[model samples]
Target: MLMAMRYHIWTEGCQMNEADSAKLAAGLARLGYQEASRPEEADLAVVNTCVVRQKAEDRAISYLGYLRHLKEKRNPGMRIAVMGCLVGPRVDDLKARLPFVDIWARPQDFDAILRELVPENDLGGEFWPETFPEPRGPTAYVPVVHGCNKFCTYCIVPYRRGRERSRTIEDVRREVAYLCGRGVREVTLLGQTVEAYGKDLPDRPDLGDLMAAIHDTPGLLRIRFLTSYPKDMTEHIVRSVAELPKVCEYFNIPVQAGDNEVLARMRRGYTVEEYLEWVDRIRELVPGCAITTDVIVGFCGETEKQFQHTLDLLERVRFDKVHVAAYSPRPGTIAWRQMEDDVPHHEKMRRLHAVEAVQERIASEINAALVGTVQEVLVEGERGGKPFGRTRSNKLVHFPGEARPGELVQVRVTRASAWSLQGELVAAAAPAGS
Candidate 1:
């Protein structure tokens, strides 16, 4: 018997990238390649890179340099591949810079890489199969839409990932059904701007239509979609969340900045008042919805009053979670090409920490209010010797229980903190979608 060829993939960035890695891993498996524990042990090593921020790009470049050294010194026969945003649409410059790379693949383009590995075997059109060989976990991410059309000045996603493209409703439905059959209880539909799903499709179906199609999958207990654009989050989608029992009441809408001037500078396409109206509608339709947002501090030419406006918005919204980042100008973005990155690094960090401090206090207070309330938690797995999971509202809860993974349990909130909740097991609920 011959030993199987081993491969390793190192992934970075968002959930969409994670899904892409899973697809690549499955493709490698189909080609008779076994997974290696580390890059050093593999005959093929792939770095699925992210270049959204300057730091991420630098880290990826440094890792590639390490791999080059490893191939030269230890594993002379090892084949190297670089995929994702780092490679982008054109790789001539990258090819000249990183000559050691055997394959360079664009984001979500798995067929190109797989074909390069095994030239003779045709992958029969689509590289992503309807079902994977094994269940990944209790949770899975499925990309319903790819790329972005919105070119927010500070974002490189549009340039790297390209224009918006949505998978058909039936196609997405099939994937979700297959995942549920293999024991995935929770699915998060993904996109660069998730709310823009189905706009490009022939039937012109929206995300609400997509969610409605997938809501009744046999084993699926919860459905979620994320990184929504405020301008694209239609009333239909909000109503869908209110109507669908399986759909979790959670929204991850990124309000990049709070001030109108900063938002316009970023080309976000919506005003603070407009964003607030959308939030109000969501709250009115779906009470107790866990609203989370992303914020970037110290954009091009942001002043103290502008920064204070963001703080005011944070206080006003009191989001369940706030993802804060200091702006790092990426080359090829509009901000990099046209605007001066006038904010000093120290000032950026200061604003970032300030936003964090405000959010931390708000979150602590909001979670504290959940004490004594019963939350339905789908036990993901054991953490710190206790069963841990998230509520339908996406709040993390750790509780002492005999509940196993994939089992939904009713938990009584005992204590709450800024990040998570402490709970006591109340009862074991029936199987999800029962």
Candidate 2:
């Protein structure tokens, strides 16, 4: 018997990248390639990269160099492929940079990439929606939509992933059902802007409708969505989370800046007052819901007052979690061509630290408040000699438990910190027939 040829995939960026890598892995497995534990050991390697942040893009560039060395010296016969948004529309530019790379698969050209990887293997019959494998872990990500049309001035998603294209509700429903049958208990819907799901479709089934459909699935214990735009978030979507049994009450809305002028410059499309009103509505409708946000500091022309306004928003909103980044100019963004990167690198870091400090205080207080509450957490896996899981509100919790992964458990919060919680096991929960 011939030994199976091995392949490895190095993935960078968001959950979407992870899901895409999973798809690639499945496709490669079908073509008789086993996953290698290390890149150097593989006969072929794929790198799925992101260009959202300059630092991340730089790392991807460095990895390309490393892959070139591996090919030239250690593994002369190894084939290397690059995929994902970092490849973007500048294929020739990237090709010039990495002339040794065997394949270049842009985000939109993955099918061709698959064909190149498995030219001899024709044993396929609709492997995506109906035949896709279940997530090896309990949680899975389902992309209801791909790409974006919003074209926020500082962003590159639209140019990279193309215009918004949504899968039909039936398609998403089947995918979620398949995942549930494969023992996945949780599903998080993903997209560049998930709140924009179904807008391009004929039937116009929005996210609320999609959630209601998936909420009726047999084995799914929890459902979640992420990184919503405040402008596109409808009342129906909010009410669905409030009313749906399986949907988690967690929101991750990114208000890029707090100052209206700054937001306008970023082409965010919503005013500061309008965004705050939406936040207030979510809190009013869904009490105890955990609200998380993403904030960027040092955009092209941010002033001291504008940065202060962001800090004030953090204080007022009291987000459960905040993902902060100092802006880095990317080659293709409008900010790169139109605006001056005037903020000193040190000033950007200082602003990042300042906002982080305020959010840290809020996070500590919020976690501490959960001390006596009983939280329903789906036991994910073990870490630090204890089992860790995330509450429905998306807080990380660790506790003493013999409960197996994929089962729900009630944990009484015993100790709390800003990043994670320690809990005493109350009882093993058999949620959704787990």
Candidate 3:
């Protein structure tokens, strides 16, 4: 009998891609393949890629080229596949461009790729699995929806990943239950625009309804979702965070830009006033909610005043964290066709740093407030002799302790830095579920 081959998967891009990669891994395990610790140690390698920016796409293609040497040296039957947004439009072209790549599947056909890995079933019927698997370990990504309906001018997601499609409420519940049974304590729901979940489905069970259902789930300690579009954020979702026991108060809403005119140019759908109002409402409902955002600096035609508006908005909103990026033109997007990437590279860097500096000061101030509080934290695990966990508000905490992983504990924060809290564990405690 042939020995089962160990496989390695390398992922790039957003939370959705990470979830897709996890599902693919579970499918591979069902087909008798175990995970390898590194790329070179495996008989198979899969690159689940992202195409959000021009540089990211270039990096994925270049990385695929680099792996050609491994292909040449590995077993004659070693398999390599490329999936996610990178394989969307140019599947045939990518195959033609790099014939060394053995499989070209999109995000939808992840299960099919796993079946193709089986030597005797290269053409298995409907090989794609329908249900999310019970993960082999503690952490997992659960994608409640896929694709985006919004056609942001600079974004390639609408063109490449296509329109939004939500999984059924029943399906999501079953998936979460399966993961929980496998000792999974935490799950982050994934999507291109997660707030837009359930739009296409009949009866339209929106994000709030989904969260309520998940909150009722037994044995689930932590629940979170990501990449919410500002326009689709409903008041109900805000209330869900306030009311749901398991829902983390941390919201990852991406404001993108702060000026109305710049936002109009970017087609963000919400103005700076509207964004701030929503933030205000969130703060009102969840006082200690740790709000974070994504900011795009130097969008097309952004004037100095508009750039200052972004900084001003940051100062006002005081986001706990900000993911700052300089705009890069992507092929086949509205901005690429209509606007100019005239913002000089130096200017983009300057604006990005300016935004970062303001964010650093705000983060430091906000974190400093937690210095003497004992926060209830779900003990995640240990790294480098220190145990780490996440607070109810999703703040990361680590300290010296003898607590077992997955136990909830109260940690008195001895020190607070701009980004995270450092402390010592007071005593291991139980969350409501525990």
TM-score to native of every candidate shown = 0.96, 0.97, 0.95
Best by lDDT: 1
For candidate 2, what is the TM-score? 0.97
* Model 2 regions more than 4 Å off: 120-133, 431-433
**In angstroms, how far off is 286's CA in candidate 1?**
0.6
Ranking by lDDT: 1, 2, 3
Model 2 lDDT per residue over 47-112, tens place: 999989988888988998898899999999999999998877768987887889889887746565
How does residue 336 of candidate 2 score in lDDT?
Answer: 89
Worst 10 residues of 1 by lDDT: 125-134
Q: What lDDT would each prediction earn against the true structure?
A: 0.90, 0.88, 0.83
Question: Which pairs of residues collide in candidate 2?
Answer: none
**Steric collisions counted per model:** 0, 0, 0
The global Cα lDDT (0 to 1) of model 3 is: 0.83
| lDDT by residue (tens digit), candidate 1, 4-84 | 999999988888998999988988898889999999999999999898877888888998998999899999999999999
Candidate 1: list runs displaced more than 4 Å.
122-134, 432-434
